[model samples]
Target: MNEFVYHPSGKYLFVATGQGRVEIFKMPELELVRTVAAHSGQSNCVALAVSPDGKRVAVGASDALCFIWSIHETICERNLGRLDYHVRAVAFTYDSQLIATGSEDHCIDIAYVNDGSRVHEIRLEGEVYSAAWHPQQLILALHPRVILVNETVSVYDYLATPVESDLRNKNAHIHCCAYMETFRNDSKYPN
Candidate 1:
């Protein structure tokens, strides 16, 4: 398996394979629910994301495309289409209204989940490897290589302004990141 993620409702597990296949498994029992042939050829599917409501899923492949599927049916309802380079990561906002994708083209694209209309595109200095959304805010965490050298985690707001940057781990490459929900209700972390 290339990547896998559980549904927010804890009822399903989505698995993406290196051969461009996506399989959904039922929770607890782990029964094979459905399978999707996401990409053509032998492209690797490196990213998979389930929407907060557990009604949708996004799959990112080396074909430079992101496909959105409905949990109710085994069909791709929308496609973010082809990009400049292969997609490395994908994420959905907490409200399930937006989908974010990071690509080897050193760019991040934010699009409406319902219509696939791009809302914003953020260009970075290096290739974006991963992206994550804050639990309760519009903040986005991006794991990108700075100037094709340093692995950095950049925190940005909805407007695409860098609010903070952490370069503590010089030797480690952060492949993925997520915000803890423990501080979601705290006043110190404002949306």
Candidate 2:
């Protein structure tokens, strides 16, 4: 993705290098307004999803840690609850109250935004490359092609055990499932 933000007020962009730095500049003029250190290591695998209103920034790393970077504070204030899985994909709920991470570990780490705490650890099968919550429903979408995984999508309540099961195949392997959102879902998936 191009590292820039454009606007009619003026063309602008923020170039974020995975190497813990970000540079912002105007279009054409390329005037630099800010040069800030953004994070550690190559942020390429990093999952950053900004709230729709542009208020909160959710960043997850290979370390199995999810952080809620509060932008209003002008500093990287990480709301914690370091998960034990790899985060493959990160997204915010419609209200941005819940942060859902799909990982390689056959699970999703559904967390509350305010405190960055996990509300439920949703488990699935195979390598969870992509995951997303229904904007209105509590149902979570799992890639049906996850190798050896039953072609069933799991719908989980906020904290209780999953309620739907007619969609699963029998004899699904318990091991070799994805863990954590880093690779696709939450950081804790067993892969």
Highest TM-score scorer: 1
Q: Which ten contiguous residues of candidate 1 have the minimum total lDDT?
A: 174-183
Candidate 1 global TM-score: 0.76
**Candidate 2, which segments miss by more than 4 Å at Cα?**
1-17, 20-38, 42-45, 134-139, 142-145, 149-191
Question: Over the full model, what C-alpha lDDT does candidate 2 score relative to the true structure?
Answer: 0.52
RMSD of candidate 1 to the truth, in angstroms, is 12.3
**TM-score list, all predictions:** 0.76, 0.58
User: Per-residue lDDT tens digits of candidate 2, residues 12-83?
Assistant: 444544554555577789898776555556543355566554666665555565566655564666544445
lDDT of 1 at 99: 82
Off by over 4 Å in 1: 147-158, 161-191
> What is the per-residue lDDT of model 1 for residues 93-181, given as tens digits with 9 covering 90 to 100?
87898788988886788777888876667766657778888776666787765532222344443344322242322342212233212
